[model samples]
Target: MKKKLSLTSKIFIGILLGALFGIALKWLPSGTLKDSILLGGIIKIMGTGFINAIKMLVVPLVFVSLVCGASSMGDVKKLGRIGIKTMCFYLVTTAIAITLALGIGKLINPGLGLDMSSIVTTETVIAENKSLVDIILGIIPSNPIQAMASGEMLQIIAFALLVGVSISILGKKAEPVKILFESLNEVCMKMVGIIMLVAPYGVFALIANTFATVGFDAIWSLIKYMFAVLLALGIQGFIVYSGMVKSLSGLKLKPFLKKFANVAGVTFSTSSSSAALPLTIESMEELGVHNSVASFTLPLGATINMDGTAIMQGVACIFIAQIYGIDLGITQFLTIILTATLASVGTAGVPGVGMITLSMVLTSVGLPLEGIGLIMGVDRLLDMTRTTVNVMGDCACTLVVSKSEGELDLDMYYSKEENNIAKNA
Candidate 1:
């Protein structure tokens, strides 16, 4: 007899087992099973490996897909139109996200009553140099090869788009380069498949190590702050995106969300827009985003698509201020909006950049950065949710932009296709 399980079943099993083992190790005493074998070794190793494997695929996948996207765009005006549309979408969505977060944070005042002594803070000395100029300059790589060599995704993206656009001008000559990259893109996706096979084992170890010593007690302690941030994400995902879809696309939200649901799940697991860009782009295209529009919008969205995170940052900052009993004036809140948006440019592509940006936000509003230490314990956990929202936001924006540009597949966008059969069906 052969045993075959559904994809959802497999993923659920991974999540369920990881959660169970994690809780056991965290709550139970220092038993041998929890220490060297279960908690100490296997879980941490697997989790780190999984994260690294996913990250390793981020740069090439983004570069190649974007290159393919640009090469497919036969005109400069299309590229320009797409870029302007994507940027507008990103900026507008980001502003909306922050406003929603800030509004809720003010109303809820989660930080006002929380006890701060219960959380753990990492004391690693970090370099805090962040500015708009540095981020802007970094986008154009001084050396393209070095950018790729160092995994500088923005720079790699810039170089790839330039090369891709120039290929169109070459007429017949660009064929060889396009063919080579298209083949490479296929190879990179193959690698993602191989990496995904180990996902369960990776998730198991990661969850185990993360929870082995993680005191849920602390989490329960700051449930108020967590609730505020989570509630904000929920509102943005449910209310805001729904309104955008209904008003802009004139499409039913359920069917649309159903199509790209898997991409959102993957993004939450990865906590990376760039890592999730391929799936996002694919999902968008399959769900009717025209190739030129998707190529233009999705890549740009991946680079600056921090809407969910920005919302969380704003809410988290306000909550911290309340907890610290720091009163911020209206000007300070406006300053936060400026800093948050500006910080996003620097925060993109940097490992663990959210907290650093949060630190900047807190500092701008006169909130204690020490309060970041309080939320640090739960950041990774909440990151899962925010990442989901980020990917979903990108998808929503792609749909609307493509629609407005007259590049959307209306039939595919509205149809609900089965997971395994979607591509062929």
Candidate 2:
């Protein structure tokens, strides 16, 4: 009897085929069939549809799963403790990511001896800086419905946590509400499974569209800068995350990566952590992270855990500073680390948001904003790579928190049969 291919294997195939198909399109001569019908018409619709399908699940999944997780915690203190641990892991990892990027950036010197004439400088509008107090206050939703409508993840997380905590507080009195949320959570998970069935096709369309549009020329133009960012992302994803999983959770790295590859492929194609949240949660559960931990940590991670973005900012900071012939001192380097780390919390888990936050980091260190425009052409490809790293960080943190809190199922984590079921499911 022949064995069936797992979803992870299929997704990987989709990514590979999609890249090749896209490159073929990029090389073909301009025509209505290539430009109008295929790329713009079929590819665009399919890619957008796939992204929308995933996004449609994010708000409900986060709200419902988080409610179920929080209500089931049974102890507000444990919930608070988990929250602290998760945040610490995210922040620390982000700092380390930027520091790593800085180190690599300095060593690589990607921007040294660059041709300034080849660079295009576009106008970049810097968002008005917000105080820490403002960011903290923004988390609390005055009207949660409005927050949900706007898809404000931080606000939605805050509201769901409150609702979950209240259900726990009321105990038997809130039993019915808790039951409803649990049912909703199951439905949402099922929804994730159903949507994921189309992921391979969706990933193909998305990746195809991306490469078809962006092509390799842009990447070659800033090859050194791209290499710097990609290198930092690779270290953060493979070494940093794998090391943390081994040291903190005592889980073998291979199984974790194997299980996570499907979600990582989706994340890389979509370039949006928010879009990949459902799969991330599902993958964590497959790794034996209890939904309570996966629910709370992954959503929060999606919002604030941006190791990948911080890496980009770090490398870009160095690249930009070098292009402008600016010598950054210890204080400026320190400021970039601090600013990028904190800015991760405010950065939305979407494509190109990192570029905006990179502006803020550059501003802090007195780097010219026009330097951003220089790398804008290649940011799309880099964004996809970094988003994969970001989601990986979220899952790794979930595993660590789940293990420490006694929420992990060791049997499930190590069971090949269970992992097969999860991949097929």
Candidate 3:
């Protein structure tokens, strides 16, 4: 009879072992660890494959869940209102994050007095030169089958919203279809659970591959800029998120932090809210948040909500500007905030998207795109941190919305300590 450890404990062990394993490969003797088996490849392919599998589920899960949530509203206008409120919350918070990041970053001047003479320009990332027409038109796909095949999230979102609205209009006639969708949702959720079972192996490989290929010595050159990005993330995750959670709901900070530790660890290692969705949802449910709120807000948060990533863009812009000895005016600062927020909406929650969106943000405000190469190598680790904040923000938003809608189970929330008692009884 082995002891049953908590999810938190298990993940903590995985992270510890992953880090030590990674360090050993980097610092110690290579032997077989670096030879025949190729530890890094296993980590790279498995970790990335795990992420892709989860993302493959994202479109279907989100589409069905949104349709279910919206159909229940029974009022298109009310549905519109909720949509507005949710998007506005995400967009506003994102803009504020960028603003704070730029302000703090510039004040600190993280890139000042830098010598860029040795900076070798790597492969440059370019943003899709999307016109307003292209962006709007791209929202509704002509072929949803192709959209799903291609994993186009925006098209999937649009298609699902339409289906959900249509189902709501069908009234009693839609009951059978609704029942089928709900069942489909349940089956899909079970699949999410199965995917997470191998998470330890996947996560280990991903981290190991990342650290092995791009060792810390590679990032030693840009340590100041990296810390600047981290400082901004810390401020946003702790100060901003804490304030928002407290102000929006009467819940205290202590429990939120305690519950989020596991979720944060998963996000940091996985570098993806989409990948961490299952754990995040479970954590919120365990904390007594309603399924309706979690399902509605968390998926949306994974897509268009990227406060930490936006902060990275802000700091990067400043650093690049200083590195090139260019001064930014007040108008330009506002422009960066607006552009970063917009870029995040289109930024895919995947590895390459950050650099692409950062390129977009830089171009919008006339910043040099060349500076992107400087940070390309280290973006993976920073992505890990940013994704953790993304998941954290999602959970907090769910709590706030739940509390406001009177959907939260306060008794269950405060009874977190009663898990053992309930289990025993």
Give me the candidate number with maximum lDDT: 2
1-425: candidate 3 lDDT, tens digit per residue:
99997543554455556656766777756766584366535654665565555545655665665576555546325456555666777878898889888877877877765644232122223234455566668667899999877555556656866887788788799989888887886766666667656555655654454345445532343677788888888988898889988998988887789989989888877777898898888888888888877777788788768898898989988887776566776656665776677556544554444654565556545565545545553565587888888778778778887887777888878786566668889
**lDDT for position 129 in model 1:** 44
What is the per-residue lDDT of model 1 for residues 1-425, given as tens digits with 9 covering 90 to 100? 98897433454466557657778767777867766676556664666556555655655665675576567556435467766766667777788888888998888877664444222222222223446576557568899988777655456657877887787667588899989887986776677667656755665555454445443533443677778889989998888887897898787776677766888778777777788888878888878888877876676666566778888888887776665455666656665676565444334543344654565565444455545434544566688788788777778888887888889887776565444457776
Candidate ranking under lDDT, highest first, comes to: 2, 3, 1
Error of 1 at 180 (Å): 27
TM-score of 2: 0.59
Q: Could you tell me which residue pairs clash in candidate 3?
A: 43-205
Candidate scoring better on TM-score of 1 and 2: 2
Task: For residue 105, give model 2's deviation from the true position in Å.
Answer: 0.5
Residue-level error in angstroms, candidate 1, position 29? 25
lDDT of 2 by residue, 1-425 (tens): 99998655666677777778989998889999998898778876766666556556656766776677567656435589898899789989999999999999999988776533222232222234456676568668999999888655566767877898799888999999999998987777677677667767777776675567566532343688888899889998889999998999888877788888999889888788899999899988987889988988898888778898899889998887776566787766766777677566655543334544565567555566545444544566677888889999999999998999999999988898666779999
Clashes of each: 2, 0, 1
Report the C-alpha displacement of residue 262, candidate 2, in angstroms: 1.0
lDDT of each: 0.67, 0.75, 0.69
Q: Which of candidates 1 and 2 reaches a greater lDDT? A: 2
